[model samples]
Target: MSNLFEGSTFCIHTFGCQMNKHDSERVAGMLEGLGALPVDTIEEADIVAFMTCCVREAADTRLYGQVASMKNISVREGSPFNKRLIAVGGCIGQRDGAKLTDELPHLDVVFGTHNLGSLPALLTAAAQEGGHRVEVLDAADDFSSSLPTDRENAWAAWLPITVGCNNFCTYCIVPYVRGREKSRTLEDIAQEAQGYVDAGVKEITLLGQNVNSYGRDLYGEPRFAEVLDAVDATGIERLRFATSHPKDLTDEVIARFGTLRSLMPALHLPVQSGSNRILKAMNRRYTREHYLDLVKKLRAVVPDIALSTDIIVGFPGETEEDFLETYRLVEEVGYNQVFTFIYSKREGTPAASMEDDTPREVIQERFDRLVDLVQRKAFEANQDEQGSVVPVLVEGTSKRDTSILAGRSPKNQTVHAPLPAGVEIDELIGTTVSVKVDEARTWYLSGTVVNEDA
Candidate 1:
């Protein structure tokens, strides 16, 4: 291990959700400040960091496989120059830091969710002394920023308004891992949005474990709408947010999306199961009818708002009827995207203790059926967008072909078109370009950019 500053290139492989993506940005900023440039390939890096997650057991397994490959490549080749210094951090690091180090001796540093601020210091020590270090600290501690964040893009940024969760859902590990909810000050958040605006950010998603419950623990009341209005005043071109809980969503929040031009017409609400019994078993608090009613009300406020949802196919005691109810609900809503999953019992969660009589083969069968239904619904939904023009934000050249540039709409639909010279991300990144939906895929659309309308 060598000082992070000693090398000029580093690569980061981030897993999990937008929160983890934000964490990666923070790490990138710190690395850049330490004089390490970002490298897309691991072979050319001085440090290679893996930001991991354990929300799903599959994610945990994925990390181990990656670690094994890295160890094999570096140990067998005996080339530190090309191998790069390996580091593991984030949620998986918090859960399995010591165990990972004991199992894989090649890792140079291990940091956790609570120790993001200490990443630079850990890298410094690892480089100078050469060995392994773990800095998880405590799970309950709040992370107040004393770190840099080299945001991967300028137009879009994830500003963490709050972190952690208080709701102890029977099927979720977030409460156990992320600790208690801690809302950052309103001034801090508003100021952060202003900073992003100053940095040419056209859009900002105020992120949190439970966004609608923001400021309740600190400001003594729900101030999400107030904060939204405050951020809107900053003149950011677009606004978006995610993962809203059904119980916490309010009319005021829904109404703002309609009135506030920048608030994009899209929201992802997780209705884990359509059956009330399963919802109760999962400690979700809201019923299926209640969620549907909420969706109806949201549509009333924002007529064209795209609805997306999450569905868990087989909870412990799910029956065929229960699965059918979910499928029917999926059809009824006509979700833009359905994040479907078969339940995986998390360790230390109440669901793990409950009798999961539903066999894996049965769950797998149901999951496959659910996915098939989602695809049919998705195709139907995308077909409606045919001949309709969509406003999209040009991201960059498509990964598959550099001859074409790609971007997303305010609603986050991916669009690809030819890359014209002299066009920069800032000039065309956030600006709306009319994309004719001549061709549509299950999730994205391929269309030529309309120059006059843009």
Candidate 2:
């Protein structure tokens, strides 16, 4: 890597999941190593990069709109760099490749999920040739976790034990764009986690497309439980994982919730739909009964665990009965949070070609009903915590009011507390404090700081 980007100001606009966010962080770290300074906004940047997502149609629209809008903006007038360069990477870049440069003629560099390390070279080439330089590799040459990172939080980190997805759910584009599952060696994962602990990180979220399926490709069977034990052994204060598939979630992993010291009492097991028919059509590999049973076992082991899920309401050919089954499941689960989505057809996905006679308005109605149920269920779940004391890992002050310091509880619930009289906000940013809940809203809990040293 040359110092071609030396003294340049860069800003990265990230749009997507934790994996994409982590990728952007690595890119930032790489640029900074080449002497580029980070700026808050694109207008101030001599180099603008977009870490994009193609999971939903809305993400595609937003990325295109933002990239197009940059055409009229220029680099900061007083900056040393003479011209601004725009680059796009992540899922969309992998999916679209050189087509992006054709669509957005101003694009200078286009790298993909598999070739993040090539971005700087591509940028250098673009600067020399004054033309687009695109590199989209079909397979990953290295695990991204091995890359340098400029994490957003000094005290928290996203640790990827695996990358990509093997399960091709009918509605998802993840497996297509991210490619097949690739698990990093367990020894490598633990070493990185210990490094984070040594660097004073308080939290680590193990990231993967389907976390419960980690190590299956490399080890010949899922060893996610062993991965959890290794990370927990690093003595990090908190540990979490995301985007679990119901089919791959085993009893061994569930058992860790009751035993692991650093594992948080929270899980995000995405059950896309509740109808067995729709589940089969979506190729989820788990029936409604099996999913409910898993939930039961999870609760039996860790009763106070905060459960959250992703639900897609309007899948192709979803009937009224199917929606009702989903409604009933939501009522039964009483999740702490629900990420609801109306299905959007992706060009290469199997569900995109499925027949559907249902009217748009009918789907909209089902979506609205699901949203209503989800909100009520979330509110009820919060209400259950009204008088309980929670230890919150302070993130920062709330955006709406600086007087209120905000953080997350063990269950990953947002908790707000007034800043104590003598304590500065920065002092509490990375520390855990005991909060006594006074009120519970639909989205968060209001509390007072009861113990700062907690």
Candidate 3:
């Protein structure tokens, strides 16, 4: 096929989870493959695409506001194209479809989570035909991993072992927008991981809505442990997965924490709420006690594992007692990090129509208390890392201080260190180096370089 987008400059704005980020990378790769150059900002590009999220009402508002603002941006005087093309894809496009162009009349192309590969064609049609071209597929025709990728970091990659979700949590729109669970074949995933490793990638984070349920749809049973084993054999240095549902977290997968050599010692198991009544209402399929037991089992195997979680402050019919339960659970978990959110009613979710009598002030107050507790717990967790030497996979120079290098430890803690004497920041961007802890803050650690050769 001819490169239809030859010489055009494009930029993509992405929102939401790692899955969406990976999707954007694939979109960038596709555009680049069609002979388009990537620009850092929308104003500089002939095409501006948005990979959107509709998980929270806030995300919808943000997407609408940003897309609306682009109506004022005009094509550069000497640009390669006659006009700027605006495209929207991912969750919001999947949900709203043709309605999006109606809402944002300037939108030219509307793709979706399932039809990301259709973006170039749609954009071409819109450009030549001069009308809105929207194609929102109801199901995925292929695994997106098979598509080319333009990873932001050459040393790191997001590999999706599964796409979509089956668990219809009352408060979540993910299952509805993303469709049912569809696991990629284990062989395909292993081969992809091997490819990343062969290409000098240092880290691979397995992506899925609920990673614990991986391979269930394809193999008729959850084989996530085997997936880990397969990826671990690929010789990747750092491995991780996200958004594990507590109910589906099996003993076999938990054992991998102690056994897998390449698996990082960090987990993002989201316990959305700690009240059993609220959990039941959310259709999470696990009680607070069951979640606590799972945590206990995880700690027993990997005692020093860094734990992070997501929590919702308020839901329908939540009372002070329910809120207390959540507060107490946070205290007990003592997580290294907590992503707390005040409940935002997504329109299609069941919770949206439920009785939410909790006042906005009450929810905000609860959120504030949770944030304070989370910060304290995080500070305490970092304090434990003080005086220890850790190997950090360097990301880049710290944004707050240029002379300092910033990276993540195996537990995913942000560890910063001064540049080695005579060493340039670029030299250490993707290399692993040892840092001896000198200070521990609430969210990150600072240290001196202990092993420059690592």
> What are the per-residue Cα lDDT tens digits for candidate 1 across 187-293?
88889888889988988988887898888989898788887898898998888876578889888998898788778888989898888888999999999899989
lDDT tens per residue, model 2, 1-454: 4567778889999998999999999999888988889999988898889999999999999999999998898668876555688999999999999999999999999999999989888888887678899999999978887777899999999998888898899999998889999999999999999999999999999999999999888889999999999999999999999878999999999999999999999999899899999999999999999999999999999997889999998899999999999999999999999999999999999999999989999999999999999999999989988988899999999999998999999999999999999889999999999999999999999989895455
Instruction: Rate residue 381 of model 3 by lDDT.
Output: 89
Among residues 3 or more apart in sequence or in different chains, the pairs in candidate 1 whose N, CA or C atoms overlap within 3 Å are: 2-127, 3-127, 29-150, 395-407
lDDT of 1: 0.80
Order of candidate numbers by lDDT, starting with the best: 2, 3, 1
Off-target runs (Cα >4 Å) in candidate 3 are 1-4, 452-454
The lDDT values for all models are 0.80, 0.92, 0.92
How large is the C-alpha RMSD of every model relative to the true structure? 2.7, 1.2, 1.2
